[model samples]
Target: MGSQAPGKGAKGPRILNVNVGVLGHVDSGKTSMVAALSTKLSTAALDKHPQSKERGITLDLGFSSFSVPLPAHLQHLPYDELQFTLVDCPGHASLIRTIIGGVQIIDMMVLVVDITKGLQTQTAECLVVGEVATSNMVVALNKCDLVPAEERPKAIRKAQKRLAQTFNLTKFAGVPMVPITAKPGGGGTGTSAAPDAEGLEELQAHLVAMVPTQPRALAAAGPLLFSIDHCFPIKGQGTVLTGTVLQGAVAVGDTIELPGLKLSKQVKSMQVFKRPVTKASQGDRVGICVTQLDPSLIERGLACAPGTVPTFNGAVAAVEKIRFYAGQVPSKAKFHVSVGHTTVMASLTFFGLPDGQGVSQEAALVQMIENLGRMALTGVPMPFDKSRDYVYQGALVIGAKFDGDIHGESCRLAFYGRLVTLINPSKPAELQQLRVYKMKEKRGVIERINEDQGNAIVRGMFKKETDPAIYTGLRVVTGRGEDGVIESSFGKSGKLKVHFAKGIQQAGRSSSDNAVILRCKRYINEHDRKRLRQ
Candidate 1:
């Protein structure tokens, strides 16, 4: 059954939405399986991107959904109906980042494998990425028709053995593996060219038996946090953003925040899997239209919520060492870090560990500095109260040696990280018109009015003196770490004596001619004046 009405009685299947990711190496039958399933039982399409048709490989994420029969045994459970939005992730080595993006939002995955090739390089990397996402996995031993019918049992055993050894320490231990023949043009017998309806039926039954529809705690309530994976403008519908909802729910007429873009927008419309819905909850693949915002302002890897999510350039987190990673945690080592849907370059600065040396298997707290992107924000940032039991609640994944042929046998090291204390850099002060003062002696410089100045007018919101709210004792900062504070605000010009705690330290000289000052201008703009105009 397709996605029916929300409620269900004992007679019919109850429609429960679940997102199942189809992930594997390139040419591993991920797209084929989706096409065949959609053709037979559902109404979703796969490989709609033009690049995918030209190259005959998935270059981006493709989505297709279908409904499978709920077994008689499962009918008595909480929700008898199960509808899966199959997320087909690209498997090419160059597109591994996109694969991580797909894996980031999946609840479970169907790992398709070519029975002949066993486990390729990208396949292993996909598994590692899925592990970091904490998604449940079930393997599809595809292309079974390529091997002789007599040798099918042997091929299945070999794939199972490799998986057991690879997942010795992970939660993927003893993951169920099934055999199938995903033929060309969505045809599969138990082989390459012909289609076998019975074989497909068995596979669907297995899926229904293995996966369950479960609701997550605290997902229904909280700020409506959604990540944007694709954005574009429609002819008359304004801008649309498409992605899976990571947490909470959103409805039409609700206002949301895009912190990175510094814009607030209202939800004009919402569609889930091409069916218009009044609201979308977590795990639903949705496309949302907002009120006339520029699509260019939003891109992949940005998040939307009820308000601006907390952003920081650096954080101090505890690194949980993966047993399979062969190398030690190097100091200042650059790695691509993925948090939520945002991935950026970050460096690790190790602190004291158990042996007071290189990284051991034991967990160690380290500082993570965001070296590349503008900022790193999390779905749920740490709350201000530190004494709570769960102070560190967010998750991070680090990928190293990703450049060049990442699918080589030697390059397999990507693992998850945990946060301890998130480090937020000093925020820049609001822009203001003030000049640096130069005293006769360099040691005691004070704030001074700009030269060639006239009697300033208090026109509009412009004021002659600084607001008293920003007086002395407030910490002042310029270009990171170069900090000072207002010691005295005692003049008509609101000139304050800035005392540099560490003294003015600049390049080249012990003291410099210009002292960078930080100030918060308290002028009301047009937008603010409207409220006060009444």
Candidate 2:
């Protein structure tokens, strides 16, 4: 029944939704670089807010998209047939946790290095992280334009050579390093916005060749990993879950198998961008509506779906110990771990090796004990189990000696036995028009910022009186700033309160008004201004 996903209800030529992440040292221009990769102009161009500009650091993740025009050979394919979502990850040491978080969910990735600066400490660290976590990678020798014409190619070469010699990133063994500037390309001054268009085109062709138009085959079927990266509610609509499809597909009424985060909600609706769609395919990013959950339950890095996907128990005998590299958080460690969107409290218990051979001793037996919780399980060799926790324990996974290796041979998710391969929606005309319009609209550019956290803006039309989606969407987006009583409560009072400035007041503004939403910029950030202008 399953050969390859046939083009059944496709809206365009076979569409492959590819999500690529940028990893590099701080200030290596990961964000600026992605802005250049987009098909349209983006405000990430001026993200140099006072705080970020002052420190030259990207605190949160930034997102943008662009379409890879099919090769002249594939042009006959719908123009928007192949779309790519690029996530710009932070490179700052302080945000190492967040940076690595980006790699956990992506498929293929691009590593950006400043040609002029070569690879820094984090670049090397990021390489090792990728080697251990992902298999496909490409390097972008950013700022070739910074070097003298005679020196640029050599600079790019040195960087490429470094990838092999330094980190031994064999997965990207023969991958070419393209040189260009992210500042202009990131759409700042529009410098090389196309970033050596020909080279980029060649790179895309190479990627397509490597990614193979088929989903990577796995052992079992049924459970799908839906990594939630972004979430928002449409005015009259309910909540939407957006993320790259790690594995599996979803049709109008299909049940999802996201075992790790313990979510088993039925999909209410599905869409690509804002356009309605009947199905979602693997390796694609989609916004799905789900039932039976508070918006708070959904956060970034959440793996979810309906029914039993897989699960591992607190007492998975094979486990030895879990630890991170030096300078990594928690000397002894204690915190929450997530599978899909499910958060579980876990305690770090070091075990296995006796502390001789190398980083991780070669032995398997209880070494130390760290207390963990029920809802959340500690990180093991593979993806977490469903609510019940039945993750298969394997030798390679348990055998591997790493202070902390997120995967093990035994840890794997089940593939859905029956499937509906979505023909890439064949909506070229629709894609291009939307790209042009969306590229111009600039929505996420404002108060609502990085959705991995709470929303800053409350978007809804005010009525003289009557029903509101808030009744449906709820005042869910309300809540407080990074601090205050708001975090403690939701919906009615406590944390959800917003104080409106006297000069600017909503008609229904309650009598008391000083707090004015702890959310959104007090003086209005550039993004807010843009939304206002729009």
Candidate 3:
């Protein structure tokens, strides 16, 4: 496909595509910045949504492109042209899901910040998203023209210092920040004459310099996985699915599956930024035209080689709580989980190795990345191994030794993780294989002791309606460090007989503080099983 030249009517040279996400707070000129730099636009570009035009804020993702000659560093590659596809993501707090979905496809990011406003709430949120999505970033300090000529330099320096302080805690520390006025004189409405943008050329230069070093692993090697962001039927032709190619490659005649709908369609044609193309590969934003599928059935989803993507009910991941979130992340709580371009509600259960049994923090992070990479390559979950014992956590909290005070108004990014397993709830056999459990403990006073029989009647451990038979064989411990086993049910009122082989300690028998404690693990999958049955 790289060897193939452009179609007869196509204007540009053979192009190598690169996706750059344009993200920022609402009204930070993200869309205007793209418009100033882009030379071409896709069907869905530039606030095309009716609600967006009426409300004067972006509510969905927008697409546009601009082409440049291949840089000196990339001349060794195949194509002579480098096309930067601008993905303008909505910055509204409520539309964060859309921003997250857009970030997954980009190779780098251009974070736009209002120079006058410095870093707002949504701007900080975009930075957090960039930290998780991509490694390369360039900060665009926009609306520089608003400052007086005498104060411009000082204002820019002050904003830069504040941004430096903010990024000091993030991975994007030391990233380049360029002053730009995407739309000078505050002209956003279409009625006004278009104004020449300031610093756009310099911004583009920084983007081109970063392109050569950006990572594009498995760009054309893995199984075809195309993320469909827009689907619509043409008048005479078939339906067109416009999106970015996430993995592998696809040609005009290859068969593709809509895994979400359990349907397959052959690619009748392909295009990149409205230019006809014979093939498209990973990282290239292209439109695949197909037939015999209703456009309404798919708004945004994955289209891949048959049988590559699977449908599952639950998943397990190696999660780290986001430091900015102030609230606790409790287990079994439902969160809006975004995978690729789809966001769904998912119940989370957290487990880790015992205190002394766990690895170092650095080692855990490395292992987590590797686990995520494996799951990404193959759409299968890492099953919970039953042979190993794990400690269950009631809530995810930052250790006081590691946590630092943060602003009260920061975005709530609870936690992030790499998928470990994709659970199929309908299969009881599969559910039994998941070994994640919650540790339960109960304590009660020993009402009476039968020293001669080497047994004691435990009264407070079980309630009136509780059945002790289920825990008859389990072990128990006393506050004074005596070990005992549950022998059998004692009486009708939910009491049990506990036997101590070494006999109860003398101090424990007399001390009111001495109490019996029982600890056990309750598998989480059992609860899921009961929920499904109900």
Candidate 4:
């Protein structure tokens, strides 16, 4: 459909920037739905990943933009424009992390569902993430062309029932689900090449009715907070960063700082949806040309702001382990925490004193560490940077999604919280000692010995370490307090062998009967750990 010219004597409608993310299970037609909608306005195709072309599965986040005309009745409204940034998120379980990244910037979502498949595992995961991100939602009953005509109504009804129950507490409960056949190349075909089941025009109108355009009031007035999603170099443009401006605005020549990276750069130029603009504000998907920074240094998950970005090593937040998360999060247990597009390994401590005291007794902590019932307010150990303030004061604290089992197919969400505190750096000596102990833990276990080579065997903490310098000569202490040096790897199993510094004849314990635990010469004083709690 072509855009109608503005009525004479009236100003052309201003484009309202809105971000809508597409999510669903693999083969649920999310990308195809995006393509179907892109044709309605000036939009590029959504699936641009090379692997997407090869495997027909979206491997990463794909983006496109299009404009929808305001309804005739609403044409007189202050904002007569509906410009939407369609973020197509990957549907495969392995790529859920990418979907979480996309969710951070989107104002709302369009959940595509394959009519025949109904709700799948990843589909539910997508919804859960959307809930955690607090994004508004609309459901797209896609692939109507594939379902048999006689069975279509039943499928739609069943889906509605399931969705209603799923969204009982959500604002989108009872939200309309548009049934449409989303063809790959943009546009849809009904049974036997008929017109779209839910016409494209109707879907467009529904989108506008369902999701309100973001207000420019606070978004334009607040401090700038832009979470970068992609960065690359344009031959003449130097380095360009593309992302949705989460808050405030930035003009050309404005200086931006990335506290997490400890770097600052100047904004050489800026564009909104490819149109050169003097400035870009919140909610607009923008491309920023930066000067005095290497393109390779730019990465996703880093925030760019006009003022100082608060750096934090950790946060205090209300946490809840999903009912399905069966794994235990022992104190100091390593879990991968993903918030926005950044994932980092973090340690979790269930027993936090009102004062920074030493770790609580295991029995007491275990009793209080209930994964079910009301959400528990807990302290998570974030990466500590000693050079900056130890707390984040930003209004928006990135909430991490905890996955206790990274290798499993289960879509379990274990943790959710805002970053509040940064790792305290006041005690450098104790912190350094802790680091040495962790490094030793990563490489100090002896599995067995090779009879022919007469050497005890071991493996690197990460399964294997090709760089011998990292493990060799490292000091280690065993469970029985036996001191040793990491000699070498046994073979390929990531196990490591250590040679004891002194004889153990008096103890009379063989390597087979004994185990090892990494230790540091200077351990964190129990008193120091207690002081931190204060």
For lDDT, the strongest prediction is 3
Q: How do the candidates rank by lDDT, highest first? A: 3, 4, 1, 2
TM-scores for every predicted model: 0.65, 0.54, 0.74, 0.65
**Where does candidate 2 have its weakest 10-residue lDDT segment?**
414-423
Number of backbone-clashing residue pairs for each candidate, in the order shown: 1, 44, 2, 20
User: Candidate 3: which pairs clash?
Assistant: 381-421, 382-420
Q: Is candidate 3 or candidate 4 better by TM-score?
A: 3
lDDT at position 65, candidate 2: 66
Residue-level lDDT tens digits of model 3 in 1-534: 122236446655767788999999889999888888888899888888999899888888899988889898888776878889999999888777788879888889999999999899889888988887777899999999999989999999999999999998988889999999888887552312145879988999999999754347524776888877899999779899999887788888899988777789999998877888887777888888998888987778788888777765555455666667666555445555666666554455545433243674334334433222111111223243211111111111111111222333556666665566555556666666765444567787788888887788887887867655567788899888788999888778888889999999543545554688887766655744212110
Better of 3 and 4 by lDDT: 3
lDDT scores in order: 0.57, 0.46, 0.73, 0.59
Q: Largest TM-score belongs to which candidate?
A: 3
Instruction: Give the range where candidate 4 is weakest over 10 consecutive residues by summed lDDT.
Output: 434-443
Give me the displacement of residue 166 in model 3, in angstroms: 0.9
Taking the tens digit of each residue's C-alpha lDDT, what string does model 4 give over 136-212? 67788877766667987887788778777866755557767777877623332111222343545666766677554
Evaluated at residue 477, the lDDT of candidate 4 is: 60
